[model samples]
Target: MTTLSSATPRVSPWVLSAFWFGTAFHWLLLLLILMPHDVVRFVGEGQKGTYLGVLTAVGAVMALVLPPLIGARSDRSGRRLPYIRLGVGVNLVGLAVMALAASALAGMGGFWVYVLGFLLVQFGNNYATAPYSALIPQLVPPEQRGRYSGVMGLLQAVGQLLGAVTAFAVGLLKLPVLVSFALIALVLLVPALITLRGVREEGGAAVQAPRGPTLTWRQLFAYQPFLWVFVTRVLFALGQYSVQPFLQYYNADVLKQRDATTSTSIMLLCIIVGSIVSALIGGRISDRVGRKPVIYVAGTAMALAALLLLVAPSYPVALALAVFFGLGFGAFTSVDWALGSDAMPSASSYARDMGIWHVAFVAPQLSSAPQGALLDWGNAQGGNLGYTLVFGIAALFFLLGVILVRNVPEMVGRRPLTQPDGNL
Candidate 1:
């Protein structure tokens, strides 16, 4: 009988791929289902942005704090799956509350309950995400990270395409929105079940025991390569997220699209198409060329896409812009993880450090409300100059991120980072 080595654990790419597909389905729906339109209906029309932003902000606070702590715990226990299951359970409870609140039994009282439910989901989702992402570096050898990231991106695009298409179809059918939500929830559960039953984890190999001195938060901050990556990601996210939550409104008010749902879904499909193509190729390109070059191309394309969207007059033009945006975004998403994985200071603190890195992903929540308020204030002056202005600013943010990324002294795919004197 052969015993598994602590340093190397056999992890199935298929299982990991399945897990990402399910998680993408779960995550995208959780965010999308509570869009500005839903908030306007539930909370109030004029204050939709405010209410949506506030709820997300509150939820984000939990997301900000929970992931790293849970990740640290997972690191110590060397058990990622247990924490993953616990997060799923917590999210289900939140989803249940949300479903019930939206039901006839809850009535207007459901609004507050919905808020509570969403916050719970945010907590659980973030906690789960931290551990789940940490698995990539733990399982895959360094050389293969880009390929795996690409495949994961491919599945993510599929899940997103399915979610968007189904959302449009469900709206056309005039089924209860809650029913659609239930369907998305059910879809999310498939991966959870696969992970629990089919995915194998050797407890000792999941994470290693900390060696010598424990890494302090301040020390983590001092790691220059990672610090730059973290900052660049935050800026990129700010640009990306600022426009995402409000695209529906842009269609309805700016483009004068009567069928906002269909329009939104169509644009999403365009994005999916571009993302699928680029993600499939971009990861491998990064592997051959370098992560930074791919990211540079992605950032440049995104900024240009945003500028185009700002001036886009018709739905067709906007649809074209969405494809460009997706191309850039897909490339970024495909290679970004490989870059971060390379920057990890050590394996022992991967979860905790990655959890901190995850903050860049969610920290956009902090600014989302303010940006929404800016939109409202601009609209108050008449004309939808607000949308144009916000998107323009978002473009600048993307450009700034592109500039900042160059500061990180990193080499080509899977190449080691070292100082001038050959020190890491």
Candidate 2:
């Protein structure tokens, strides 16, 4: 049986996972802070949820379409770094456009401009991320993947933490929106540069070229384990998006916080703290006990936390549930990557396959777009019923994810590289 080289040089997991920091930071900052603020500024608080949903849905569509094409292109070219570089450049342009739109344009016109910028951002981010995700499969051995995934989760959580802090400071100090946009650019650029310099493919070479023709759509769909992983991920993302995009509004309308931004940041801080702790622990534990168990526990915790948040009664209770949710989320994210890596059907098509898997993450936003309208309608009926309905649905998604994940067979110690046929 073939095995990866035992003598491969050890690269720091932090260096390997550096770009994830930027990825997590920018998305959290945009979703949790800037987008909500801008939507309200443009559309008014009454219709902010609906407008935000439309914008996110549009952006999500762009995100869904770009990555697979870009990934496939990179796979055919047998190069990933150039795409990453190109993506970063494009992402910065989007940020600049968004800043100008928000500052110069006004009302719905500005919103439309902002949407154009956002679509560019999605295109660039996904272009980078699809190839970037292949690094673990290319670099790390099967035995070490769980630990590497843990590091990824840790960095992602920390990025989110920093994003929350930035949001808090921006709100407290009344910092200009451009400052926040500049920070986003900085966060994305620095870590991406680090990853570009610090990481390398096997023996400092490009990815191996495919020996056979690429899988057809029918062949791809026939890959059962990969499909299971995709389905499970879609369900999990559904749970996450159902709540994440509307959190600031939730604080304002449900908790009645005078400072909704600060409250939302505080809640995110709790989630980040819990995530940091669990990410460090969960990835390593999965290496020992297998991915499914960790996912089971993590999914259950998240579902319960979402349920608890439904009747949280006060800000403090919501904060506590956020931590619990974070713990689950962190563990799930860490193990989730490892699981996806394990289920990869083709070693040569790593980027392309990973990009398809990534769609699971963004596709949920399409389904979740309705949530914004659902929230509005429920709130219109009084008793903060929208919050209850959304949170309940989130919990259901989480629970379903936990149950459906059982269909994916565990393949933790089995290395995909060993199988020339690309069958796990």
Point out the worst 10-residue segment of candidate 2 by lDDT: 1-10
Q: Relative to the unseen true structure, what is the C-alpha lDDT of residue 424 in candidate 2, on a scale of 0 to 100?
A: 30
Question: What C-alpha lDDT does candidate 1 achieve relative to the native structure?
Answer: 0.75
Query: For model 2, what is the error of residue 214's alpha carbon versus the real structure, in angstroms, after optimal superposition?
Result: 3.6
Model 2 Cα RMSD, 1 decimal: 2.8
TM-score for candidate 1: 0.92
- For all candidates in order, the CA lDDT equals 0.75, 0.85
Give me the runs in candidate 2 sitting further than 4 Å from their true place. Answer: 1-10, 201-213, 417-424
lDDT of 1 by residue, 1-424 (tens): 1111224435665567666777677666556544555677776657766677677677778888988898888777766777788888788778877766666435457788888888878877777877787777666666777887787788888888887777778768978867866876787778777766654565434443323234677766687878898999999989977787777777887889997777887888888788888996888887787788888999999999988887787889889889988999889988877777777665665678788888987888777788778877887788888887889988999999999999886644343322333233
Model 1 spans with C-alpha error above 4 angstroms: 1-9, 105-108, 203-213, 411-424
How would you encode candidate 2's per-residue C-alpha lDDT over 277-365 as one tens digit per residue?
A: 89979999999999999999999999999899878889999999999999999999888788888877666677888899889998899
Positional deviation of 5 in candidate 1, in angstroms? 7.2
